[model samples]
Target: MCIRVGEIENMINQMRKSLISIAEETGLNSDDTICYSKKLDELITRYQRLKMNNKQKINQKLKIVTG
Candidate 1:
């Protein structure tokens, strides 16, 4: 039951969209939106790194299986 890289990317995109919508609904100013956007970007970066590490682990297991 492993998640694929594409799925992870999709999840990140969805999260960003949701955050943007939330910010808009809150009627926050541009500066506030920018701050939240920065936080979202940081979160996305961390998720990407985690996904990459998981992918590497899966690849290693695959290599071992095929070897």
Candidate 2:
């Protein structure tokens, strides 16, 4: 299944909330909190990369059509 930008955004939001809750409950240095933080970082990075790629694709298409 293709994951759209909105789905990734929702996942990012959920991950942020989960990370915050875990840190608050277990302390910032706890292993679980650190793990969630790392996962959140990964999700955010993925989102950024996907958005950049989409923008580049759109630019390429526009150039092909109008250049």
Candidate 3:
């Protein structure tokens, strides 16, 4: 059940879109909605961090192989 980076990125994009729609419709009036939005933001931030880390790991591997 290995998923590719592209698939993971696509899933994140979908979640981002869904979150945006929810925010637009809800307007953050409810505490629950605001909390949910915060969670989504954190999720996206984590995904970005993971992606950056992965890129850095690959670069390190490439550097080792070349050097």
Candidate 4:
């Protein structure tokens, strides 16, 4: 479980870094680049929230089983 959480964190970080790099390459001052960055951030946040909710559900199930 710890390893999986760590992996997810790393994946999210990598995705954010990649998006930032792409934005930089495209020139952040441009409206398109800014829009892309904001979209990416929103998507990532949504994904992470979904992941956390799923993890919590699984943990709740595990607790029921173990307790």
Candidate 5:
């Protein structure tokens, strides 16, 4: 299924929350938490870069239309 930018943003928000929740949990050792934390960071970074690239594309389109 195709995912929209809004969905990506929503996922980013959920991951942000999950990252915080994982940080707060006491029982999990660093070994377990490290994997989860890295995955969240990767997802968030990937989505953010995607969002930025999308913005750049839209701006280019606008410039083409206006020029």
Candidate 6:
């Protein structure tokens, strides 16, 4: 599914809050905390990838226009 940057940002914020709450409840090294941590990591990675893809597309368009 195609997701906008704003949506991804919102998800990231929510995930961060959830991770913090989970970590606080169950020690950082606990299973639940670890699971949330990995999920948070995945969200961050997805956000980074999305940004990079957009940047690359912009650069490609610029090159074509400037050519």
Top TM-score hit: 6
Q: Which ten residues in a row have the lowest lDDT in candidate 6?
A: 35-44
Sort by TM-score, best first.
6, 2, 5, 3, 4, 1
Error of 3 at 35 (Å): 1.0
Which tens-of-lDDT digit does each residue in 1-67 have in candidate 4? 2335456567667767877787778776877667667766776676677688888999999999998
C-alpha root-mean-square deviation, candidate 1: 4.4
Root-mean-square deviation per candidate: 4.4, 0.8, 2.7, 4.9, 2.5, 0.6
TM-score of 6: 0.95
Give lDDT per model, in order: 0.77, 0.93, 0.75, 0.73, 0.76, 0.93
> Over the stretch 24-67, how does candidate 3's per-residue lDDT look in tens digits?
88775766567767776776676677788889999999999998
Evaluate candidate 3 by giving its C-alpha RMSD to the native, one decimal.
2.7
TM-score of each: 0.57, 0.94, 0.63, 0.61, 0.67, 0.95
Candidate 5 deviant stretches above 4 angstroms:
16-29
Residue pairs with backbone atoms closer than 3 Å in model 4 (clashes): none
Q: List where candidate 1 sits over 4 angstroms from the true fold.
A: 1-29
Please provide, for model 1 over 1-67, each residue's C-alpha lDDT reduced to its tens digit, 9 standing for 90 to 100: 5666677677778768877886887656766677777877876787788878988999999999997
Per-residue CA lDDT of candidate 6, range 1-67, in tens?
9998899999989989998999899899999999998988998899999999999999999999998
Q: What is the lDDT of residue 42 in candidate 1?
A: 74
Shift of residue 5 alpha carbon in model 5, Å:
2.5
Clashing pairs in 6: none
Local error of candidate 4 at residue 18 (angstroms): 10
Model 5, span 3-26: residue lDDT tens: 667877787788777767776784
